[model samples]
Target: MDLHKPPAGPPAQPPVPASAQPPARTPEGCLVVAIRLPVRIVVLVLVLPVRMAWDALVVAGRFLGDAVLGPLGRALSWLAKALLLWPLIGLWRYVVVPVGKALGWLGHVLLVVPVVWSYRQVLTPLGYGLAWLARGAWAGLAWVYACVLTPAGHAVRWLLKGIGTVLAVVGAGAYTAVAWLVRFLIVVPARWIHAAVLVPTGRAVAWCARGVWRLLALLVTGIGVVLYWTVRILVVLPALALWRWVLAPVGRFLAVLAREVGEALGHAWRIAGRISSAVGRLLGTLFRWIFVEPVRWVYRTVLTPVGHAVRDAVLRPAARAARSVGRAARQALAAARETARQTRADLRRMLFGESLPREAVGRREPSAGETRTLGRSTTALTKD
Candidate 1:
């Protein structure tokens, strides 16, 4: 076998879909077809006007949204931004931001700087001095404990050990006497009563209880068997018989009726749509012919020439007269402005009198006749 070649026997077939497979045709009766035709006809008659009205309402709503609501919504949004949002944004940017920054700087200077300075200059040195004093006190305590308290504690411990030994011998004797008295007075009597009386009584009571429990259990089992049979005969059998003979058949018939009605409604709706569309097209064509065509003809043939004549005969001369008047007015305004300007100049000159002439200043660069070269220096260091 070659490694590169695929090992195959027969080519695989593609699976067929369940929907694409041929359906088993059932026989349809003549009565069903007759009934279906009248039902669909009635449904279509009822649905046609409704479909046309629905389509009209949809068109009207779309027109209203486009022509009225859309621009209104945009204007409202722009007005809100201009009246409310822009001022708030300006206040936040120009007023609030600067105030907040100043507050932050003030807080740092008033609170944080003092806290940091106190911690570094006052508290830190104080803590160190206190820590040094604590260390010295701790050293003195350690010295007292090692030199004075340790020896005193050893002496007390020795004294306590001797006293404890004497008490231990006395306590042992008293404990032995107490044990002897308790055994005879309490423990022996309790053991005897438990073994001799309680054991026999408990056994007799338990045996009687078991017998009563068994009798009750048998009685309960018999009652349960009778109730089970009674319920099966009275309730379960009748319910099962009713479901099998009456209810199931009624449910199947109703399901078949509902399915047929649904299919008929769908078929009627599609036919109604086509009828409504044709009616709408006819009405639209009639409207265009009756109204729009006449208006367009009048505009093209009669009104256009009349409008052009009016523009040429009356409007043109009026516009020319308006332009001439505007030009004359502008010239008069300019002459007035010149008169005012000259009057102001005369008044200023009369008040101040003639101005003094300014003096000439010398040039910083060398003059043409005094040009310096390599042979002659201009600096004081190499003056010639």
Candidate 2:
């Protein structure tokens, strides 16, 4: 039996089915389940209303969709057919067709006609003119380039190229000589001095820089701490004191005052509302009792009876008398008009020798003296 070697044993057995196994027991779980069962009942009780409402809502939706939707959809379809489709068909047939035709006519007349005219008359000729002008400009530009620009550019390029190269060479040589001389006189000495003196000086400066940096860091940290404490002492504590001593108390007092004022206002408002309600009720009662009811009573008890009596008694007699007066006046006026016509005719016959209408009555025509007397009477009546 080596330590590393496994001890061979029986093979592992498959687990038993839960139905075949004995039930596991946990007292704590039973206790927890007992506690949680009541909690679940409470939760169910709490959620019962919301769940019922949700189910009711679902039922209502189903009812609306299953029962009401068909009629509503049919109504909407009928409206669409009657109001939308019919009117749209009519508009397309009558109005839209004519408008489209008019717009097409306008487009042809205003846009197409102008475009065609411009293309033929203005744009075509202008294009030819521009082409000719462009040709002339091209020729001129070619001539100027050939005569002036090309020669000038060549001459300038050659001069610049030659002079720049010579100047650059001389300047480069001078710069190289000056560079070496400066290096010999200054840079070499400076490098030697840097290796000998500057290295130590730089180390001293670096050490000083580190000391200064450490001091600055300490100072900054100390300043931050001091600032923090100062703020706590100067600003924070004072703010806390103000809040505790003054602001909080003031806020509480203001809240109490506002509540009192609101309560007073509410009380006053209720009183005023009651008073106004009473006044309105009194006024309504008075109006109904003194005006509406009394007027209705008077109309019913006195006015209607009086009106009927007057219609039967006074108005009937008056209407008959008016009719009699009107007939008598019409007959008198007609008779007077006939008499005037005869009299006027007689007067005309006397003055202008015109025969009187019904010239002789019973062979006793009116005499001249009678005619003259009739004329005078007629003139007086006309004057009157």
lDDT of 1 at 268: 76
* Best-fitting candidate, scored by TM-score: 1
Predictions in order: lDDT? 0.91, 0.82
Which lDDT tens digits does candidate 2 get at residues 31-84? 444444454455454554555455557767988987999789999999999999
Candidate 2 weakest lDDT stretch, 10 residues: 375-384
Summarize candidate 1's per-residue lDDT along 233-313 as a digit string, tens digits. 999999999999999988976765666677778887887788878988998999999999999999999999999999999
- Model 2 shows how many backbone clashes? 0
Candidate 2: where are CA atoms >4 Å away? 1-28, 36-89, 184-186, 205-384
RMSD of each: 8.3, 24.7
Off by over 4 Å in 1: 1-50, 148-184, 265-270, 339-384
Pairs of colliding residues, candidate 2: none
